[model samples]
Target: MTTDTASPIPSDAEQFGKPLQGWRLRLYTIIFEADTRAGKLFDVVLIAAILLSVAVVMLDSVEALHQRHGRWFDVLEWCFTLLFTIEYIARLVCVRRPWRYARSFFGVIDLLAILPAYLAALVPELHLLMDVRILRLLRIFRVFKLTEYAIEYRLLSRALANSRRKILIFLSFVLMVVLVLGTLMYVVEGPEHGYANIPTSVYWAITTLTTVGFGDITPQTNAGRFIASLMMLLGWGTLAVPTGIVTAEMTSMRRRPVTTRTCHACLTEDQAADANYCRHCGAKLSPYQYDREEEQPVRR
Candidate 1:
């Protein structure tokens, strides 16, 4: 190969269609820290933010969320949003291939995470919707960016995308359950028992099922407590649904492992046509060779 030092190695964004060097890479790395580690971190942060946001919501309803504007919590949340905003921008640059990156699924994820903050900032009125964390939290998938570049990960991605509808249906069913339970809890516990509204109570149901108890609300009535206990037990299965769905798909599409090295007895490396056996050392190289050879016209 002729060397051309004069030729600037295409930027990493140019080389692998992503920039892994420069300040942009650094920023993105800090955001991810590991394989989807950045995304995982983002998940942890957002999870915290959402929990905090939810707490704030419930506290506001129950008149409990604020103790001096939650100075530390507020500071932490702003820091997280700022970090994510920087990460979002850095990734756009890291994915210097605007068209390629933008069209990609994870590219969309990266776009989604930060858009809300900006939207909230741009239009203060919409700020009210900022803490609607459930829907917006899908932005956490941007962490998939950490693994998006690998060829091996394609199987996992394909599996998830293929099974998405089924997973969605399952989740939908869970939502229905939550809705029903929320309504029941609200009615049974009454407005004063912390099931203030159906939706918030439904959120409480989801939190309970996912075992993410934030301790924000409790069923004050004995009957409501009994129902809540049953729901809590049932949550184990509800929480496992998505995992089970994905695992089953993964098992079904499991790739067969192929040995790259030829067997020593065969002395063949994925035998080519006309190959009878090892050219250097004769061996039974034709287990499937006979079958393959039969498919081809034999030279007389």
Candidate 2:
């Protein structure tokens, strides 16, 4: 008789359960990946919940509505808080390194979105600051979670990043101009003419430069008015500098080809498809091959 030996196949419990595998993998995909139908559905529903919860929070702020529907508002808020709590727990459960996700920008935002209501419930005296619930509004950024699925947002983000230094310099120049103008206006108009001090004059210069025209403070002297007019003129030009810088960067980025492959190490998406390295973090990237014959030129 011949003896035969065969090895047993490992179960999912043995693989995924040990290190971010199994049901956790499926949960992670549904919660974080936009490429799959299930993931997309999850995002859509989550966004809807965020919007609805924000709307309820807004209505709860109105005194008349709060007095009449206070109980209903409390119920809705608790329900939304519970949903977000579950989502936060799910995210932690699915990740191999939960702290990494917890420390990420969106992870912190997700926690803030639910914390205010729970805090208010636990500390009734803190109800006065219920407006903190409005921080949940940051959840609107969750829409960016879909950026990995789009090319335009990727290019836009890249262009903004490229233009950051130029924009910062322009903003610094604007701040210097405002400081100079504010000091001059204070000297020209003096405290008697409603230019109370340097700080107050700076406030006036900022409002005028931004064209907010609050009308609370007005220059009473001819010299101050002239200075205000010049600042106002400069503001229009200042507003365009960052725009032009970003647009120029965007033009250059648009001319280049893009890829949808996300970086696993940095979790960054939208690298150039043919790139051997991530443009954002310089991590290694694997390019997926496409059928050149079937690929058509993309028109901007």
Candidate 3:
């Protein structure tokens, strides 16, 4: 007798190894088929994992975490890196057409997150040159981005995505203005009053623009104070632009219509007979639903 093993290649396996049932036809439409409560919960677990990854990155940068328990922290970092590396490898093994995914953006990220740790071990000095363990902070965003699969979240995401270019352009200009003003202030205000250098002045400008108001550094001269006033005014409107963009997107997302495509198991649409699920989302199609001859509507 042959013992059954989990398929290294994931084929029709429901989300997170949970069985797909109850309109799996529709459930399978998602990259991660998660229509059940358990599946949904598992999805949350993945999100947490991504957040943990970012926490690890931030924690690694802490001097205390490094100084107090260097060995323990090293062990923890290695463990997390190993687990993520193995998971990345597993994804490659299980995903159909792994090469296709490998070439894609997320595939590269999966590789990037773990590659640095391994590189750190293999090469002597190259590790220092390319310790991308810090880049894992980006992974946190990907975890939150999973909300796009949800109809509501996707709508909100679309709004933000649509305005991304414009927002970036606006931010670039803001940064340029900050730099120019910061340099001017650095020259105008002498070194004794915290505007000692161009970089320091720029840092203060950034803090002021973001409305952080970190008073650790302050300007003492008239010219410096004038620049600070302008920065404060710029901060008020500049900071709100991104927030407004995101808020507007969220508002528009709510007004859009919901679409649940034909389920592979449930024949809900009429087509040219060659249709497999709706062209929209791979819902199984039937000719009778739209046909005039089949007029009776029955309870599903």
Model 2 lowest lDDT segment of ten: 4-13
Candidate 3 residue lDDT tens string, 80-196? 677666656655555445676567555676666666567666765764665554443343444443463354555555666666766788889988988998888888886888788
Candidate 2 scores a C-alpha RMSD against the true structure in Å of: 12.9
Better of 1 and 3 by TM-score: 3
lDDT of 1 by residue, 266-294 (tens): 22233343454565456644333222213
Candidate order by decreasing TM-score: 2, 3, 1
Task: Quote model 2's TM-score.
Answer: 0.70
Better of 1 and 3 by lDDT: 3
Best by lDDT: 2
- For residues 172-273, write the lDDT of model 2, one tens digit per residue: 988898899999999999999888999999999999988888998898888888998898888898778888988887776655564445565554545676
The candidate scoring highest on TM-score is: 2
Candidate 1 vs 2: which has more lDDT: 2
Candidate 3 clashes between residue pairs 3 or more apart in a chain or in different chains = 262-283, 277-283, 277-284, 278-283
